[model samples]
Target: MVSAENSSLEYLRSLVNYDINSILYDDTLICSLTNNTDVGSFEVKVTKTNYGNLHDCIQVIANSQATIDGVACGTTVRAVVTRELVTVQQEHTEYVKLPNPITRIVDFISESTDYVITITNEEGKKKTTETKRIPKNEAQGLILEGANLILQRLMIQRNMPDKVTMLSLDSSSELSRNVYTSLGPQQVNINGKDIEAWGIQRQIFETKPNALPIAWQSFFSIDGHLISRYQVGSPIKMKTRNIPEAEQFDEYLPKPEIPKRELEWENDLELRSRFIDRRDELIDDYKSYIYQHPDINALLSDFLQSVLITKPENIIDYATEFFAPFNNQTADRSLFRFADEKIPVPKPNISLK
Candidate 1:
């Protein structure tokens, strides 16, 4: 009797008989980069083709536009992996940076040497390094490694490579060596279903001598689909919250302090003009209050945070209880105290009275 494991292995081995293995890589996939929070997300189509710009190369292209910050932001990524005779060359990538009203393209090619150039921007007029490219050695490029990972997964149980060295292109001065080791096949949970996946452990080694390597684990399906990736020590966190119902607490909000005019005794025209013109003194006074007592801003921030977390029936009452602790001070004293908040006013001598 053939067990499920043996059955899967047998099925994978059978794919090598003909050219039917193209289903795994040569196709289009609609993928989303999102988390449990649903806070920020973008979807794109990833397509893999046998024929690319360069000769004897396979290409993966992802291009799409999504609304970000209420503006349309477009993203385009093209990765090419070339085969030079017997050996596969490193991958070349051209990708757009996610941005606001404008976006720019940046690419990394293995053949080019690394350097930094400085220039000044027209707006800031600050001289900055115009561009930077990471130094590369014999390490494999990420795009090529991803393609290799997908292709090699077909022969996981038979001819999978023991380990491979990859190049790290993070925003750091020194490029680290990422060595990935195959940990054989294992069962992984994806979308609440247990699916078979090939486990891989990556050790990121710094350029320094005798430095320890940081470890990361990843799981991928036999078809080269990435299931999950996580660091060894850190635990992944996923949180969800329900949408809050409507609540009215406008009365509890801060009101601008109406400045008492000393010129009222002299019957000045300022207060008369204030009432007749109605020149939005509340707005001006509110701005002045915000400038003077910045603590009010922190106070309101804390109240809003508590309201968001608790989501009580009466947000006004919740705010009262939240600020109740600091309300016991005298009228003359500071209304609230923050850790770094201080006022350096010399005390008046009691004998002056």
Candidate 2:
């Protein structure tokens, strides 16, 4: 009779032979198959973490066969596997909002200086610095002042140049050489009213004569074509009085007789005489006006307001009320008094007057 262990081994071997897919193995067979002595069958199932609700699964099976007394046997195995779920948190990126363009333009105009720009990230966590040279003021102070005046005039109607391009100022004259392009007519509503205003195009060029700088101004139509050119300065030579020959001789007796020298002497003498005569006449007129009229301060104030006030129309009512009683006579009287205080009475002129 067979022992229980032997019967069990015989039963396992019989099972291996009964199954067509299972191969039989013995001590010798296992040694011949591979170096490892232990052999077994296994089943594995793999699962991976899914980003969303859906998850994926994989299945694998491994097996080894053994035989005893010409009998084959195999053991079945199984496993269920799942991957560790990993969670990732996304990072948020911050953005920055720039300053208001209108406020920048207004500040540039009022200060009449270059602007320093500062950028701040959202939540005020960090800041960056930037520098920009405002074209309006990059030129010398005089040109900047003039440009401010022009911009102010346009600002009243809520209009500005599309782009401002600054060129080198004339080295000889220190005048701005800039070009302004008009983008086009922009419709703006103010106080519940619609108004149409002309868009202007401007270009600056520095030209000759250090004493007189040229301003080449241009205007643009709504379509952006150059419509007009305004040439400023190019000061016309005013006819001055010619010096008498005797006066020239008396003035230039000590100077050399070269043609250029003679001409220069005559010109210098003529200019000097003209300047002296003008100064004397101004003084006489000022004194006479002051002596004839005592209240001149008020007239000066009025003249200043007329020339300097930007919104004359808006202040006209107030000005009329202020000057209601003061006619031209009062104005003249006041002007005369100012002149008298400013001008000194000459000895010869005092006796004649």
Candidate 3:
């Protein structure tokens, strides 16, 4: 029961069948088990309430067994999605004790800052945590497979979307495809107790970019609990089930293997519609450089302000006097002091004609 005086979130509040505000505090821990996939069985523990410093954001932690180049490997993924107007950001990460093959990271470009935390234990061992200040545009169409609840609002409203592209992180690589959605009646039975649910079917298109889509269905209880998931004719079933000791390795799984310097896109569009191949180091350098100087940022900001405010024709000459008195000097520190000091605008030389 949350109301917004600003009405910014009132619309979102109305759209969701369940309480958005209360969902963040629900103590229920939902777990899903996926078995018999090409790789192996995996368990995912979903925390709807709290997972990180960003209170009330969505978090998904998955533990699984995978094979890379035919060798068995254990994998873990902790994906954090900070709430936005529509989509969310996955730019925040903390320390992990175990090793993994890959971890997908996405960023929205902007001025940035990084804060690193290190803790030393009595045994002289240290654990490090990392955080950053990031805010940017909400990615409109991209979706996460593990946190499909992001679509709960639309699902409850019975307004399923179609022809949208979908993206997900697998144990070792990324999986993506075009998709379409449809709604239907569903009756789920757990040990013979039938529970009414909403059946949302999705057709995933990897071949021909959707000429033929593989049928996938997700069933949710009326109150929006993901009760079960099934691919049309596949034996792999993912539903709310307990897999003991799975959540224990959430933080201690092996560190992710650094992706190759070059990226291998699943399709051509994915390859062309990207910026850098892999430049985390360069991005860190950029944030570090910008964080070092707040004064310079202000100085340039004022210069640009004066440029627009004055609208001087000879911009180079105007900038020269924007902070009037070239040398370190008198009290005329005013930006566009020429205007503030009542300096006259340039008068054009016109001979009497």
Candidate 4:
């Protein structure tokens, strides 16, 4: 006789089985970022190809690329296999070339008892680890499969508990149970049509009870597909779109370059903390630009600030609107005006006309 916990675990394991034939048939999906306050608007295209053979062992291959501010930030590819309702023998690579160039490659090969993870980065950095044998019910490996796996797990346990612990391949922290509160059926307007989906409040990272919860939310379909996601109270919502072929994204994937500086940071806690603070400050500076020009889409700032050639007319109206409120001629205008035509009209008719 199976206990309730065991039964639930078994059900969770079944949903994550990588051998799900329907999901592997040369599929393409487009996910686009949507929001007014979003720092950057981006799109991700994922493609999956299936190689149906036993000897190949590398049964499924998935490729994903994300572009932010009209530039390719990174590309990831994964080769995954399934055995006994568990995804194993994953080969993965992350190529990042935006802001800086970095390449991270991970290979996980299954042994009799456990799996070994070998990682290599662009700077000739390498690290290897042996993972404990994952139980049938556990979750691990590439996000292409892990996302769907976790979604299925959450859908199954939606009514059971508000918080549940799950395993992960990440080494920064131990496996922790994340709190999830259902927002119930939300009416999502997609492409001008209303579709009902379940909303779940998620903690993007672990935080103390008294500390602020970095709120992230995901909306899932009745069939447990993630249709949309965003930070709570944020206007930005990333939604899914249909794609004809995965090859459509090939042109957008840029070749990665290695940076000159040492990419690896030394093990210094205080220095790391200060570095994190500096990083946040840089982000705050980016936010200042957006805050100053609220009418302009934040995504356009990259083009306005970086590109040598631009249609200034496209952004001139936004700049005019942003400064219109502060247009008053508070300062002495007579001393500064070379042509009198540049003077303010509202303030004592300073204009010569």
For residues 1-353, could you state the per-residue lDDT of candidate 3 as single tens digits?
A: 11122232333344444334322311122222244335444454545545434566556555545443355544344555444322233332222233442222333222223212122212125333323331222212334443455454345444444333343322221233424455666777654567776777765444333244567677765545556665676544655542112111123346899876754564566564554444666798888988997777898998998788889999888876766564577544564455656656897799778
lDDT per residue as tens, model 4, 1-353: 11123344454465544333323233333444553333333232223333344332324444555665655644354544443324455666767565556677666655555555566667335344433343333333222233433443236334424443333343222223344456777887666777777777655333334544456677656544555665566444566553122211123336889788764454778878889999999999999987898866854564455434544655767555544544565434454467546756665757688
TM-scores of all models? 0.38, 0.15, 0.37, 0.44
Off by over 4 Å in 1: 1-36, 39-53, 62-77, 83-106, 110-158, 166-170, 173-175, 208-216, 231-353
Runs off by more than 4 Å, candidate 3: 1-18, 21-44, 48-55, 64-77, 85-139, 157-180, 207-215, 239-353
Give the range where candidate 1 is weakest over 10 consecutive residues by summed lDDT.
Answer: 237-246
Would you list the clashing residue pairs of candidate 4?
A: 35-236
Alpha-carbon lDDT of model 2: 0.33
TM-score of 1: 0.38
Q: Per model, state how many residue pairs clash.
A: 0, 10, 9, 1
Q: Candidate 2's residue-wise lDDT over 1-353, tens digit each? A: 11113332232223221211111111111111233233322121222223334343111122223433334443222211112111111111222232321111101111234322222223334443333333333332222222222232232233343554444234232334545555355432223444332444444455553544334443322322222223344211111012111111123235776665344533688877988899999999999998788677667677668657655655667676557656774554654466546667667646655
Which of 1 and 2 is the better model by lDDT?
1
lDDT digits (tens) for residues 101-179 of candidate 1: 2333344444445322222222223223345543333332432333433444344434455665544533232455556
Supply candidate 2's per-residue lDDT for 196: 38
How close to the true structure is residue 44 of candidate 4, measured as C-alpha lDDT?
27
